[model samples]
Structures are given as structure tokens and as C-alpha cells.
Target: MFSRLWPVMRKEFIHIRRDPRTLVVMFIAPLMQLILLGYAATTDVRDVPLAVFDQDRTSASRDLVEAFVASGQFAVAHYTGSDRELAALIDGGRARAGLIIPPGYAADVQGRRGAQVVFVLDGSDPSIAGSSLSAARLIGQAKSVSIQTERRGATAPLLEVRTRVWYNPDMASAVFMIPGLIGLVLQLQATLLTSSAIVRERERGTIEQLIITPIRSFELILGKILPYALVALLITLEVLILGTFWFGVPIKGDVGLLLAISCLFLLSTLSIGLLISTVANTQQEAFLLTFLTLLPSVFLSGFIYPVAAMPAALQFISGIIPLTYYLIVVRGIVIKGVDASTLLPQIGALALFGAILIVAATARFRKRLD
Candidate 1:
């Protein structure tokens, strides 16, 4: 078994070495994507362009505008004289939020009456709109508290809320996303590389040679998977180093545990590729099928969106995707630094997925070879 497997593994390594493009896609592409997406995929909304229409022209209104700017969440990009101009700014996408201070704002504050200020938010992008709305509300609440305190001649407010964020104190999206990105990159490279493996052999008319040989189906399947599994592990290590050193995402858990779970993840992904190989007659079909699997995995696996937020049907579907379980494990170990006992459920799920996929892939590949 070892002798037969060694030849296939060595051949795969030779093929990878000769193919520069494969090497780039496996290594360089994921690194570039990690850097680009790390910055682009942030949820922290800062410096949101704000358009202000101050009808009061009073110190109170100016102070309100200054407060928004000082919070570092909003920047006054346009100071409009009329509502039309403010609306135009938001319509043109120059401002994500608009603040309109009514003429009686100062009088309302001085007389201890409720001041009504209209905050118009561009609702085109829900995420940005939601964040801007929250910031605006917090700023408004703080300003209201300041007014009440000044009127009471007090040094401190009556009520103060202190929030303590755990695990990710800074609330940096990269800290939350980098671990998931590592899983995504691993799945993509492993599946794509192995998905095309058997198809490539068939396309080149080399599969017939293997069919005529004495290599058993399970040995051939293991042979084809092992090399790419090693490659996937190397890719995992590369991205982990980049995610930690370059993105400053700390790994607080046991490194050995992370790698062990990663190998289990690779098993499922490689098996998925082998399964694709048996079904797809051409490399293009394999690529397409791989992408079809990857899209749902990325979107529904709690990578970018929460799986709990998905509808019950989609949520049930996500349960079957190996990436979903792997992500829970990866984020648990990498971000929360939880031990194996804490993540036993996810570990068991990954182990089950690997077992099922590998067995199914072996059966399919064997049937195809016969």
C-alpha cells in the first residue's frame, strides 16, 4: 500500500512543482486575498461622510455638529443651507447620514424642552445604515445627558453605561474574520487542486494506465488525496502565519490542536474534491462544481453572515457543509482559546464529516475506475 501510494504522491509533487500557476494560486493568491479582504471586509464604520443642514445657526447647533465630528464616527463633508442640498448630498452618495437642526433647537435646549433633530440615513446599504444609525443615537443620547447635567449643575451624569467587550476588545473585524478566512482559503485550494486531479488524468488519457495497473481503488484514492492534503496543510500554515504576523490576529489556543482540526477539515475538503473528480468528466465541470459548493459554504457557514440569522431551511443546509463545523472549531480555538473539551461537539462533527465524505468519495472513485 505504501509503495503504490508513494509513486502517486511523488507524481503529484512533480506536477505541482512544474506548474507555477498552481503554486501561485495555492500560495500567493490567498495571501493577496487575505490582505485585501482583511481591510475591505470590516464592519467597523468610521469617518462616515455626514451632511449637515443647520437651520438654527446657533451655538447649540454648531456644538452638535462639532460633537458628531469629535466622536470620530462622522465627518462633516458638506454643510448645506437648505434641506434640498442635504437631500442631494445623500442622494449623490456623498453622505451616508444627514443631520438637520431645526430653527428652535437652541431655544428648546435652553428652555429644557425636547429638541427634535432629524437624522436622515441613507438606507441603501443596510450594514452601513445600521452602524451610522447606532452611532447617531449614541451621540444624541450623550448630548442629551450633557444638557441635563449642565442644567442640574452636576459634575457627573445621573446614569452611565460602561461596556466591556471580551475576546475582541477593539471590536476589530479582522480579529473576527482572519480565522474564518484561513478556513475558507484552505477549502478553496484543497478542493480545487484535488477536484482537477482525476479529471486531469482522464483528460490526458492517463487514467486508463492507472486502471490497467494493480493499484487498488482505496490505495489510489488515498494516494491522490494525501499529497494535496499535505499541500493544504502547508497552505494552512502559510495563511496562519500571515493572518497572525501581518494582521496581528493572536492565536491564544494550542497550535497543535488547531493543526489537528485543520487536518480533519482537509480530509473532508479533499474527499469533496475527489467526489467532484468522479462526477465531472472535464476539468471545467470540476471547477464549476467546486465553486458551486464553495459559494454556499462561504455565505452560509457563519463566515461573513451569522448562520443563526439564516432561514431554517438554509440553516439546515449549512449544517451539512463541513466548513460550518470547521469554522466553529477554528474561531473557537483561534479567537477564544478554548480547549478540546470545550469544542468537543464541533470536533466530533468534523470527524464525522471526514469519515462520511472520504468513504463516499472512495466508493464513487472505485466505481468509476471499474
Candidate 2:
């Protein structure tokens, strides 16, 4: 059985070795993605360019402006004289945030009347907006406290919630982002490359040749898939090693177990690609179908979004996405230091999904070839 599959697998490997594009996709692509996305896919937004429109033009207002700058979250990029200028700065992408300090703002704080600061934010990206807004609120509260100290010589009532974070104590977005990147990068490239595998053959009139052979459908499917599957696994391992040692991400769980589960993850994604190849007569169609499947998988897979936070309908949709379970399992093992026993449910789900995908892809592949 293994002997029969080797020829197909070898053919695929030879294609990779001979094709510069395949070599890049198989090896260089993932590393390049890691380097690029490691920088891009971060939630920690800082030094947000800010434009201040201080209508008050008072010492107190200046103090307020200084507070935001002191927080280091906002960098005062432009000081606008008017609301229109402030709006223009933001609209023109020169500023990510704008602050409006209304005239008489100092009197409200000194007189013990609650003063409000108007914050204008670019609502285009929620992450940037949310972080900047929260920082702004903190600055306002701090200023309010300072005013109270000067007026009454006492601090405001504070209910400090003592929070201790475990596992990822630093709360680095890289730590969170990188592990999820493992899944995102792997599922996408692995699926995409294989999605075009058979379709490329069809485009080149090779599938007709394949049909003339005595090889079983499963043998053909395994031949086409196993090479890519192994390649995907190696890529995953390479990323894991690079991410671990180079980036200092500790893999607290068993590396062997992680790899084992990752194989299942690859099996599913690769099969999805293989299934796409079956119906797609051209490489472009195969690529489109793969991306059509990939985009939703990324969104619903809980890589960037919390599954619990999604609406009931979207969350329900995420249930069948294999990456959802894989992410949970991988994150649990790598970050939380959970073992295989703790992740049986996810393991089972991934296995089930992989099995189903393999069977479906195989059936379609055989049908198409026949």
C-alpha cells in the first residue's frame, strides 16, 4: 500500500523541487509570512497619532493635553486650531485620534462640576479606536483625581481590582498572535497549495494520463495529499521551532503531541484543498475556491476573535470549522501547558473532521478522474 503511494508522493516532491514557485510556497512563503504578519497582526496599538483642538486655550487644558502625551499611548501629531482642522486631520489619515477641549473646561473641574472631554476617533478599525478611547478615559480620570487633590487635598474613592494574569503574564499580543498565526498560516498555505494540485494536472492534460493507470482512488488521493501533508507538517514544525527559539515562545506541552494533533489539522485542511481541486477545471478556479473557503475559516476559526464573543449564529457556524478546534488545542498546549488528556474533545473533533474531509476528497477525486 505504502509502495503504491510513494510514486505519486515522489512525483509531487519532484514537482516541488523542480518548480521555484512550489519551492517558495512550500518553504520560503511561511517564513516570510511569519516575519511580515508577526509585525502586522498585533493588537497592541500604541503611539497613535493624535491631533488636539484645545478650544479652552487655558493652563488646565494644556495640563489635560500633557496627560494624554504622558500616557505614551498617543503621540501629539498635530495641534489643530479648529474642529474642522481636527476633523480634516483625522479624515486625511494624518491623525488616528482627535481631542476637543471645550472652552471653560478648566472651570468645570475646579468648580467640582463634572467636565466632559470630547474625543473624536477614527472608527474604521475597532481595535485602534477602542484602545485609544480607553487610554483617553484613563487620562481624564487621572486629571479629575489631580483636580480633586488640589481642591480637597484627598484622592477620589478607588476600587482597585487586583488582577493577576497567569500563563501569559506580560499580555504580549505577539504571544497571542503568534500561536494563532501558526494555525492561520498553516491552514491557508497548506490548503491553498494543495487546492491547485490536481487541478493543475487537469489543466496540463495529466489527469487523463492518471486515469489510464491501475492505481486505486485512495492510492491516488494519498499520493497527491501525503507529500503536501508532510510538507505542511514540516512547515508547522519549522514554524514551531523558529517561533519557540527565535521568538522565545515556550512550548510547555509535549512537542510530540502537538505535532501529532497538527498532522490531523493538516489532513483536514489539505483534504479541503484536494476536494476543491477535484471540481475546479483550472488553477485559477481552484485558487478562488480555496480562498472562498479560507476567508470564512479564518474569521470563524477563533484565531483573531473570541468564539464566546461572537453572536450565537456565528459561534454555531464556527463549531464545524476544523481550525476552531485546532486553535483551541494548540493554544491550550503551547500557552496554557495543557496536555493531550485535557484536550481530548478538541482532538476528537479534529480527528472526526479530518476523517470526513479525507473520505470526501478521496471520493470526489476518484469520481473526477473516472
Candidate 3:
């Protein structure tokens, strides 16, 4: 049995080793992807440019303006004299946020009447805007507490909720996103790229020559995937190593278990790609189909959004998406220091999905070739 498999494996190794382009892509491509996706996916928004339109330059108004600046969320990029100036500051991309304190604002605070601060936010980039808004709310609440304390001559409420975030203490989006990117790059590049390569061979009429020979269908699939798998796996490793070293992220999990889970994910994704190739008549179809699957996976996989937050129907639908499980496993292992035993359900699910994909792909592939 081992001897029979060796010939097929050797044939794959040769095809991969012979192509220098494949070698470069297999190693370098993943590293490049890591840098691009990791940096872009970060949620820590800072240095938000802000324009202040203070009609009343009173001490209280200045104090309110100071509160916004002190939160480290926004920098006072411009101080505008009128609404038109503030509008231009936002329209010209000079500021992401604008604050307008109405005249008589200081009088309202002094008279114990609640004052409303008009905040104009650039809602185009929701992630950055969200962080800025949260910070602004905190600053406003702090100012309100100070005013109430001074006016009432009484201490503020003693009750406060203590919230602690484990694993991802800062709730850094990169912490969760980098690992998912590993799965995405591997799945998209290895599966779709290799799938297209196989389809290309068939479209060019070269597959008939191989089919007539002694090469088995499984061998052909292996030949198509082995090189791509190596590339995807190498990229996954690059993301893990580089992300840990450069980003100060700790891989606080069992290394062996992480590797095992990663192998399962790569195998599953590659197989799904192969399945697409078997069904597709052209490389174009394969690529489109792969992306069509990839987009929904990215959105619904709980990579950016919490699964619990989604509706029950969508959550049920999410169970079928491999990235959902892959992200959970990766985040669990990388951030939470989880082990294989603790993640048996996810491991089992990945294995089942991989098996089904490979078997289905192999069956359909043989039919297509025949």
C-alpha cells in the first residue's frame, strides 16, 4: 500500500519541484498576503482628525473641547469659525469628525439643564467611526459626572461594572482576523488556483494524454494540489510566525494541536477547490465559483461578527461554512491556549468536511475525465 502511494506522491513532488514559478509562489505569495491582509484588518483606529466649531469660546466650551481631545481617539486638526468651514474640513478629507457646541452651551451646563453636543461623524469607514464614537461617549459621560458632582455637592453613584476581556484584552481585530486570513488565503489560492490549473489542462486537450496512461485519478488530483498545498501551508506558517514576532501576539496554545488543525483546514479547502475544478468547464468558472463561496464565508463565518449575534437561521447556515470552524479553532488555539482534546468537536467537524469534499471531488473528477 505504501509502495503504491509513493509513486503518485513522487510524481507530484517532481511536477512541483520542476517549476520555479510554483516554488516562488508557494513560499513568497503567502508572506506578501500576510502583510497586506494583517495591516488592513486591524481595528485599532487612532489619530482620527477632528474639526471643532466652537461658537461660544467660553471656558466651559473650551473644557468640553479639551475632553474630546484627551481621550486619545481624536486630534484637533482644525478649529473652524463657522459651519461652512467645518463642512469643508470634512468634505476635503481633513477631518473624520466635527463637533459643534451651540451658543449659550455654558449657561445650560450651569443651570443644571442637560446640553446636547452636535457630533458630525464620517460614517463611511464604520470600524474607525465606531471606535471614535465610543470614545467620544465616554468623554461626554465623564464631563457630565464632574458637573453633577460639583452642582449637587454629593458623590456620584458608586456602582460600576468591571469588564475583563480574556485572550484578546484589547479586543484588537487583528488578533482574530490574522488567523482567519491564513485560512482564507490558503482556501482561495490553493483550492481555486489549483482547480483552475487542472481545468486548464482539460480545456487545452492535454488531460486525454494523461488519462490514457497509467496515472490514476487520485494521482492527478494529488499532482494538482500538492504544490499548492505546500504554498498555502507555508503562507499559514508565515502569518503565524511573522504576526507573533512583529505584532507582539502570543501563540499561547499547544503547537502540535494547532498544526494538526491547520492541516485539516488546508486539506478541506484544497479539496473543495478540486471539487469546483471537476464541475467547472473553464478556469473562469472555477475562479468565480470560488469567490462566490468565499465572500459569504468571510461575512457569515464569525470572523468579523459574532455568531451569537446573528439570527438563529443564519447561525445554522454558518455551521456549514468551514471558515467558521477554522476561525474558532485558530482563535481558540492561538489566543486562548486551547488543546486538541478541548477542541475535539471542531477537529471532528473539519475532518468530516475534508473527507466529504475529497471523496465527492474524486468521484466527480473521475466522471469528468471519463
**Highest-scoring model, TM-score:** 1
Worst 10 residues of 1 by lDDT: 157-166
For 1-370, candidate 2 gives per-residue lDDT tens digits of 9999999999998866765543443455456445434433455666789899888899988988888888988889999999888866664446777888887877776666656777777643345556776787777767677677678754442211112234565555666666778888888888888878788888788888878888877888778878888887788888888888888888877878888999989989988998888766667666656666765567666677545345566668789999988887777777766677668788999999999998887777672443
Give model 2's clash tally.
0
Model 3: worst 10 consecutive residues (lDDT sum): 157-166
Enumerate residue pairs that collide in model 1: none
Q: Tell me the lDDT of candidate 2.
A: 0.73
Considering summed lDDT, which 10 consecutive residues are worst modelled in model 2? 157-166
List, residue by residue over 332-365, the lDDT tens digit for candidate 3.
Answer: 6776676676677788899999898888878888
Q: What is the TM-score of each candidate against the true structure?
A: 0.60, 0.58, 0.58
Residue 340 C-alpha lDDT in model 1: 81
- Model 1 over residues 1-370: C-alpha lDDT tens digits? 9999999999999977876544544565456455434433455667879888899999988988898899998899998999888766654445767888888888877776567788877643344556777788798889879878788854443322222223555557787788888899999999999989889999998888888888888888888889998988888788789999999988988888999999999989999999898877778767867876787787767788655345566668788989988887787677767688767778888999999999888778762443
Model 1 residue runs over 4 Å out of place are 1-159, 367-370
Predicted structure 3: lDDT = 0.72
